[model samples]
Target: MMNRRKFLQGAGALGGLMIVKPSVAFSYAANSTVQYALLGCGKRGTSVATSFAKNTQARIVALGDIFPDQLAKGKQHFDEINASLGFPAIDDKMTFHGWEAY
Candidate 1:
């Protein structure tokens, strides 16, 4: 029952609404710390974690991997990256290894 003209108008209105910014949004305090854990410390997981570290004011609190070597490597890599970003290095106590890691 609807013509193309009416459909296009409605679609335009909907798109306009989608582009509108929210009136209220949550924001973190300047000194607030956001701790995050990274599981499956493989190539993809490390890449994603690095992206977060590079893009946000987040701290990598924990790194987990089924393999000890992978966990170690991930921790070293994240620590180095975060250090370069003026963030603190991850503590060894927070790193987990073995298949039971999650």
Candidate 2:
């Protein structure tokens, strides 16, 4: 069976990608464990980070900010999102926060 990556690569090579619009075609794959981070995790960071966390193809794995509170908030928001999407909370999947763990 043709995996998703292979299908997309094939489509791109054939110039079929443009015909379908890559973003539209790949939207469903947007949140598939693609690890992202919140550099700020303030209002703007929360928005962008949450958007990706809610995706079916992405996961927010780590967060970094001068303020520790921002990191905690980001992780909390992502946890709620993941649970609402029927997936286990982030705490169940992996460790979050702190540069030492990275």
Candidate 3:
């Protein structure tokens, strides 16, 4: 029963709303206390997670890596990042290592 013009206008408005600003997305993410258990602590994962922490008010809750050394590195990295941002260092128990970590 809807006319073509009305449908097009409604679709346009819906599309506009879908184009959310980056800040809004980050703001919502910032308030989340949801645990993020990263499966891998490799370069790609580290880079993406690092950027999110560095560029926004978001925090990393949990971290995991197959290798103990890499897990330590990730924990250290995020701990420093958190400290610089005035957030607390990640607790030792929050860092998980070994293949079973994932």
Candidate 4:
């Protein structure tokens, strides 16, 4: 029963609402905790994870890698960085290896 003009107007209003700044509704507090997971433990993955660990307010909670050695290496890398920041060490239980890790 709706005409094209009304439908277009409603859609435009909805689009405007969606585009509104998110900061108007929410603010990130300093102590807020953000947890992240890295799926690949390769060179690129480890590099990116290291960057996040060193620069952000985020914590690497879970790590997944197809190779055990790579997983262990990645975990150690993040563990050392997080330790320096006084963050709790990543728990071994959160690490996953092998194909099923994905």
Candidate 5:
């Protein structure tokens, strides 16, 4: 068996061989995809969520909220964005009524 130092050196070299800068790794010539879920859509959630949806590489896949109104609002926000972007609206594939609904 190899010694600990030898094993680590081998592993590090192998891993380092594949290392790439973030900019190089994310070369945008190819299509990029980002998926996100929103658990809450209050003021803060809506703000961050709007930013996330605005990102060309990102899509909102799910939304959950304790309140029905908030959930609907979250859905509406993404629905409009998807509609404008020529994508299908993400509807309630699985809706939770409350804690008991879980």
Candidate 6:
């Protein structure tokens, strides 16, 4: 039988746990990936974004580069990564190039 004393103790424990809350509770849906954008999309950017994709639940959705060739390469690299991870390839609209890309 849960008496008043036991009930109070249980409530106190629960209250203590409630007080210790998460710093930020991310409200992400189940099986949903985090959207990631890579600026520059050079060797360093690809390396960092690749590590992020492999280590975290983030998927590179956008790539931006001043050089069109570099941007294409970046897209190919990320497309392969996404394919291997069972994610769809990045949309063409998300690929930005030219000097104005920042």
Best by lDDT: 6
| Model 2, runs deviating above 4 Å | 1-32, 91-102
- Tell me the tens digit of each residue's lDDT in model 6 across 1-102: 789999999999978767563442344455566897999988888999999998899889999999999999999999999999999999999999988776
Off by over 4 Å in 5: 1-31, 94-97, 100-102
Return the top candidate by TM-score: 6
Candidate 1 vs. true structure, TM-score: 0.67
Q: What lDDT is obtained when candidate 1 is compared to the true structure?
A: 0.86
TM-score of each: 0.67, 0.51, 0.63, 0.68, 0.61, 0.72
Instruction: Kindly give the stretch of ten consecutive residues in candidate 3 with the minimal lDDT sum.
Output: 26-35
lDDT of each: 0.86, 0.66, 0.80, 0.86, 0.74, 0.88
**Model 1 agreement with the true structure over 1-102: per-residue lDDT tens digits:** 999999999999988866665432224344576889999889999999999988988888899999988988998899899889887788888888887887
Q: What is the lDDT of residue 24 in candidate 4?
A: 49
Candidate 6, residue 57: the lDDT equals: 90
**Best-to-worst ranking by TM-score:** 6, 4, 1, 3, 5, 2
Candidate 6, 33: how far from true, in Å?
Answer: 2.7
lDDT of 2: 0.66
Clashing residue pairs in all predictions, respectively, total 0, 5, 0, 0, 0, 0
User: How far off is residue 95 in model 1, in Å?
Assistant: 0.5
Position 16, candidate 6: lDDT: 76
Please write out the lDDT profile of model 4 over residues 73-98, one tens digit for every residue. Answer: 98888888888998887899999998
The pairs that clash in candidate 6 are: none
Candidate 4, pairs of clashing residues: none
